[model samples]
Target chain A: MSEDKLLEVKNLRISFPTTRDRIEVVKGISFDLGREKLGIVGESGSGKSLTGRSILKLIRAPGQVTADKLSFKNIDLLAQNEKQMRNIRGTKISMIMQDPKFSLNPVMTIGAQISESLNAHNKLSKSEVNQRVIDMLNDVKINDPERVVKLYPHEVSGGMGQRIMIAMMLIPQPDLLIADEPTSSLDVSVQAQVLNVIDDLISKKGMGLILISHDLVLTSRYCDRILVMKSGEIVEECKASELANAKHPYTRGLLAAIPSLNETRDELPTLNRLQKEPI
Target chain B: MNAIELNELDIFYGDTQITDNISFDIKQGESFALVGESGSGKSTILKAIMGLAPKWNGSIKVNNVARSHGIDYDFAAQCQMVFQDPYGSLHPRKTVDATLSEPLTIHRISDQNERIEQVMQSVGLDLSFRFRYPHQLSGGQRQRVVIARALILEPKILLLDEPTSALDVSVQAEILNLFKKLRKERGLTYLMVTHNLPVVSFLCDRLAVIKAGKLVEVTGVEQLRQGNFKHAYTQELYAASGGVIS
Candidate 1:
């Protein structure tokens, strides 16, 4: 627990109970984050998204989460009760889900839904909350925040919907943000646009980010440090600049597997499962 | 003769036009791609070719045979489509064998027994997975089954609608390799619609950049590799994808 360290996770293990056995998906991985971007990269069933969800204590029963030490700013997250966790969720740690079309409320207007997030944590007058909502929308680079506020979630496009999700998540001004596959659902062009907005906002607020993605190149581009996860373990951790020259066999295999912009290979090399040594 | 041809094509979903007058042709054994953002009517164009979009004006010829507005059985045997999401596209209740066999049965093709086994192997699926339902298979495996169904007909052309978008990157590489192998072996024509430019560069010979139902530019993958796109929107799209040619 130092001042620069914004979040600390040690021996964090998440598992599920089956009919005959208990399966550990996240096998005691540890990492520390300052007010900087840290990316977790892995494929499906690799426990990347589970790691993000476990931080907010979002895992329900039958599904289990265990850790030796999970703390945020000298606050013990594992020790918090349900009510105490709620208090820390929005104001301290907010997450942007993979899809905005589902995360947003269909019945409520965009303004009402975003204002609800702010109203839940802060006691503000109606006019003050409305102004803050408009300002937040503008912060995410949404055009015509005035008209957009009046529309429903379905009315806006996917990229705009995701920005609205970002506005709602950051409106509370959390100390940490966990975006799980945030742009995977978006098109390539819109993906960069959304990531740029997040990068801008994170730097301005000086908040820590845990970006979870399956794509190696994307994580390397956005994050200061990249952690390659496989099964339930951290196979390799390195600076984003050094990802291309990474030493781990699995990491090298992943780097090689990504099709380059000017690809000339007759066949892209595929990752061999046997190369993934057991943890 | 062209494998597929569209001249002055206009598609509408009940009075609201989805795609404007569009024209493109894929040569025999050629790999062509349609690149665009979602809701830009790229998939709609595929649907119109597959006869899924019925209210299309203008001629669509497959192997020089003109297509009618309704479902064409003869056209189905000549061309096949592989959809984006494998989970949603396949029948949840049907076994892999049943799904693959239905197409052969529909075409009244003989040697059903060997055709099923041959296609499964060509797509790199193990024999053990032939009896499993869609839920029992992984995303990559299910997509292989979808591609197997497309190939089982021995069709000259395949319409792939964002085939590997749902899978992980490594799985995507495997599938892309599969596509290359199939194309090389069968000498098949591919009309793939994808938003990933790098994938388009790797798999397609020529690509059509579509924006808001209008064709922007049709250029070769060579221009894409050099990052020298002529059109402004195509340049913007390439810029978004990180224009690193080296």
Candidate 2:
């Protein structure tokens, strides 16, 4: 691993055991992340989300994840026991999902759910935990944190629920964050706000971020580097600004897939999948 | 006469007001779009026109005919809707044939066999997919079936709510092309609701940007052609949705 690198993954392969055979979703792939935002872009079954999940050992029994090297800040994640993994789960590494409704506990109040992370990680008193929850909620730009904290997950809107999820994930002060389609469910207007909040925290904490999304333009905007994946393989890797100038046909195909607002073309360009996308 | 005219419409969900004082007029054979954030009442406006939201105040006139707040049978054949999620919008248990035939049966159209064949051909669905259930089909195929179901009635006006958002980009292009061809061939009028401005640029002649349940800006397709929008909200939204073309 390099001196500045936060996470180093090498020869990482994840598979699911089915009745017939073991299907490999993520082929042996390697990548390095520094204290900067990295994006993984691909189609729905492209294994981008699975890669993110595998880093945290989030993949369950039927799915087996193996890597020659999977380390976070010099800690071997694969070697860690269950109890040790729990300690590292949210405190050192946090993840935010696509939809908040499914991730959030319906029975718990927003404040309790957020403060629960703080309680598990640190020996903070009741008042201190309350203050931390309130502050984190406000940090995400949620108005009226006091009232919002008392409300259940069902009581809030999708955007607000997502903000609460962000707050809960960030409260532990993780050194690394992996967000898988975090704002895919959000409306366009609210998407910027949610991303802005997450970006601001990443900057402030200098935490490494892996933003996994199907949206090429969005990931380019928020991330420092991008990894475009196709069929369980990294097709292209480039700096965020250089994405427009990417040389690979797959990258260009992805860029051309976006319908331009200028309305020059009668139809948006489609990827010629018949011709194999250049590796 | 314009294809659709909503006069100071107020839509409600039980006691809660979804949209207030919404009014618009779409010209015949025109493809108009309602672009807004989630819960901005864009879909509600479509629902109001479809009579799904019966608790709506004000007049909805379609092709010079006023619509009542209930199941208007004659209005049914004149307008149809295609929803966002092809997976959810389609019936899992029903075959493609049954799904397409249900609307015709409801309207008591005797020539079901011919209409079904015509509609499927219009949407470019393969004949082999006629007997398959929704679960057996791909996302794009399911969407095509949904489109076929709507066109089965041979409606003049089609209300499309985020039709391609749920499908892949390549599939989206295919479906979009189908929509364009259908409009030209059928002389169809479209009122689409979507957050994607680029889709609007491709498919719509005009666009109305909604915010907080109110119409904020209505711009020509030429404005999109120029890649310049006057309203700050519209520009902001354009930038947020990947800053495509703009």
Candidate 3:
């Protein structure tokens, strides 16, 4: 691993055991991350989420993850035991899921939940923890952190819930953040707000980010580098600025398929699956 | 005559008003859209038109005939609705063929087998999928089935409530294209509710922007393309979508 490389993955494969056969959803994908934004763009069932989850070893049994080299900061991730993995999960690399409705604990206060993330890794005093929770909430741009901290998860709106989720994930100041479709559930304006907050925090902390989303344009806009994934493989990799000129037919097809603000096409050109060649 | 008209519509759910005095019209064979954020009462407008929101106070006319506050088989034959969440809209246990045939049976239309086959083909679903249950089909395929069920009755108008929001972008494009082709071939009137602004530019002629149970702005799609919105909220929404015109 290079000195600047935060994480490195090679020949990563994730599989699930079914009744009759074993299905490999993520088949031999490889990538490296520095303190920069990397995006994995794919549609449903393209194994983008599985790859993100496999990084933290979040996938449970009946499912298996294998890799030739899975190292974070030169430490072997695949070699870590379960108890050891727990310390690395949130403190070193945290993940934010798609929906805040299901991710946040319904019964706990927002302050308590944020506090829990910090208290799990560090032994902080009561006042320090409370002040830190409020500060984190404010960092995510939540209004009136004092009042919001006392409210339950159900009381906050979807956007606020998502920001709260971000606050919880980032309070530990992880080296890498894996946000899997973080803003998909939010409205457009709120989506922009949430992404901006995340972007700001990542830059301020100088952390690596893996943004997993099905939206091509969104990924290109937010990430420094974009990886177009299809059927568990990286079909193309390029700078985000060069996504419009992506060489792969699949990438070109996806780029053309989205309706732009000034849409003039009589019909969007659908992706031709028969033309998809292995990369 | 207008294909659909709503005059001074006010919808309520047990004394809590969901939509204010909203009114709009869709001419014959016109494509119209209602766009807003979630819970802004865009979907409620579709529901009121479909008679699912029974507490509406106002007139709803389909093809110049006023609708009653109950299920009307005649109205059902002329107008049908395709809901959001294709996964939940279809019956989990029913095969695609069975789902398509039920609408025909409800309308007492004969020659059910032929109609089912034609509609399935029209929506671009393969014949092999006709026997598959909802779980057996993909999201796009299931949506195609839902659209097929809505079209099997030969309705002149369709109420699409966020039809493509649940699918992936490529799948969304395919479905949107399918909708365009269907509307052109059948000369259908559409009242689509969505929060996606670009979709309106691609698929509709005119759009009504709603906010907090009130009508914000009703403008032509050309204005939307130009980013020329009259209301401040509409401009806010346009900006929220990145305000890109190219």
**Per-residue lDDT for B125-207 in model 3, tens only?**
87788888989888998899999999998999999999998899999999999999999999999999988889999999999
Off by over 4 Å in 3: A273-279, B244-246
Better of 1 and 3 by TM-score: 1
Please write out the lDDT profile of model 2 over residues A126-228, one tens digit for every residue: 9999999999998999999999999999999999999999999999999999999999888877888899999999999889999999888889889999999
Q: What's the CA RMSD for each of the models?
A: 2.1, 2.9, 2.5
Give the lowest summed-lDDT range of ten residues in model 2 chain A: A270-279
Ranking by lDDT: 1, 3, 2
Q: DockQ order of candidates, best first?
A: 1, 3, 2
- Any residue pairs clashing in model 1, and if so which? none
* Per-prediction TM-score: 0.97, 0.94, 0.96
Chain B vs. true chain B: TM-score per candidate: 0.98, 0.96, 0.98
TM-score of chain A of each: 0.97, 0.95, 0.97
Interface RMSD of each: 3.5, 4.4, 3.4
Residue-level error in angstroms, candidate 2, position B193? 0.7
B1-246 per-residue lDDT for model 1 (tens digits)? 799999999999999998888999999999999999999899999998888899989889989988888788888888999999999999999999999999888888889989998999999888778888999888988999999999898998999999999999888989999999999999999999999988988888999999999899999999998998889899988988888533
True contacts kept of each: 0.68, 0.53, 0.66
Q: In candidate 2, which residue pairs clash?
A: none
lDDT of 2 by residue, B1-246 (tens): 799999998888999998878898999999999999988999988887888889988899999999889767899899999999999998789999999999989988999998888887778776777898988877888898999998887899999999998876667777887888899998999999998887888899999999988888999988866757888988888777656434
